[model samples]
Target: TKPKSRSLCMANPSAYNYTTDIFTAAALRWLETGRTASKPFFLYLSYTVPHAGGWGSWPRAPEDGNPVPSDLQYAAELSWPEVERDHAASVSYLDARIGEILRELERLELSSNTV
Candidate 1:
């Protein structure tokens, strides 16, 4: 197996910002100010979640490699184990990011033209 790469920002506060948040913000920013309406624009966005070791699992305890941001989106799942709750939270976070992007598209009048 190939060695997993680690994030250089693992120790930074921004490291906990989460991949979905970062990508969604970038997508929104581009849609708002970085694009030209005179020509077609192509944006490719991919999110990492419901996957192993987010940010290379930096937010997790040293012994736990599967990590999610320390967010409470699933904190109400008291019956679930912490790891499972974290996973569920991450998935929900991804869904929210997608919704944000879609909303931005609609706001920008790009949904019908976008694929």
Candidate 2:
């Protein structure tokens, strides 16, 4: 069945460290759930790597109480400041995830249609 309209679900802000399931699942749902096939659709993703508010973000601290992965891309360099390296690692991790999403969109043939 086709959906009459698109929808949004607002999650209560919490310190939960959700994994890629948070992102990939939503994209899969939008693509496979018949919500936007053969019609115009829009998605808004405000990534949180740069967001200062942890409680208001999706990828908060791990809901399972585990520490966030260092996501280090520069671990080979032992001379850099920890804070700077960690921050870069986080951004690098995010970029890779975004790339995955983009590749998925292309696999679905939705890349040209997406903004």
Candidate 3:
């Protein structure tokens, strides 16, 4: 098996600032460099926000109201819950990044080839 590599970022509030993470960025880079319709590529993408600091595992999470910081411009004037506002921002950021990947795939003519 390949060695497990990890990027350690403080999971606490506002620790994350960048819109795209190393994994996603790397995937996009790979897609950008050499994308072919004949070759099959698999990406196992996972995210932390909206899942981490979520209250499902423990009820106290929501009660504690741990406010997190998101992209300054993206997070400004939001209509979501205080604690989960960061989650919303995080999701949006991720969505935008994914959109970039999708656009690259389309540009490379790999969109129709991908599952």
Candidate 1 vs candidate 3: the lDDT winner is 1
Return the top candidate by TM-score: 1
Clashing pairs in 1: none
lDDT of candidate 2 over 1-115, digit per residue (tens)? 3233311232322322433436645666666665433465677766656444323333333444544447745335334444555666677777887787777677776766643
- Structural similarity to truth (TM-score) of each candidate: 0.58, 0.52, 0.56
Q: How many backbone clashes can be found in candidate 3?
A: 0
| Worst 10-residue lDDT window, candidate 3 | 55-64
lDDT of 3 at 27: 80
For each candidate, the alpha-carbon lDDT, in order, equals: 0.64, 0.54, 0.60
Model 2 ranges with Cα > 4 A deviation: 1-21, 35-37, 53-78
Best by lDDT: 1
Model 2 residue 9 CA deviation (Å) reads 16
Candidate 2 clashing pairs?
17-61, 17-62, 17-63
lDDT per residue (tens digit) for residues 1-115 in model 1: 2223335443333444566667778789889985554557677987867675533333333233444337746534334455655776788889988899889877777776653
Q: Model 1: C-alpha RMSD to truth?
A: 10.3
User: In candidate 1, what residue range of length 10 has the lowest lDDT sum?
Assistant: 54-63
Model 1 ranges with Cα > 4 A deviation: 1-16, 34-40, 53-78
lDDT of 2: 0.54
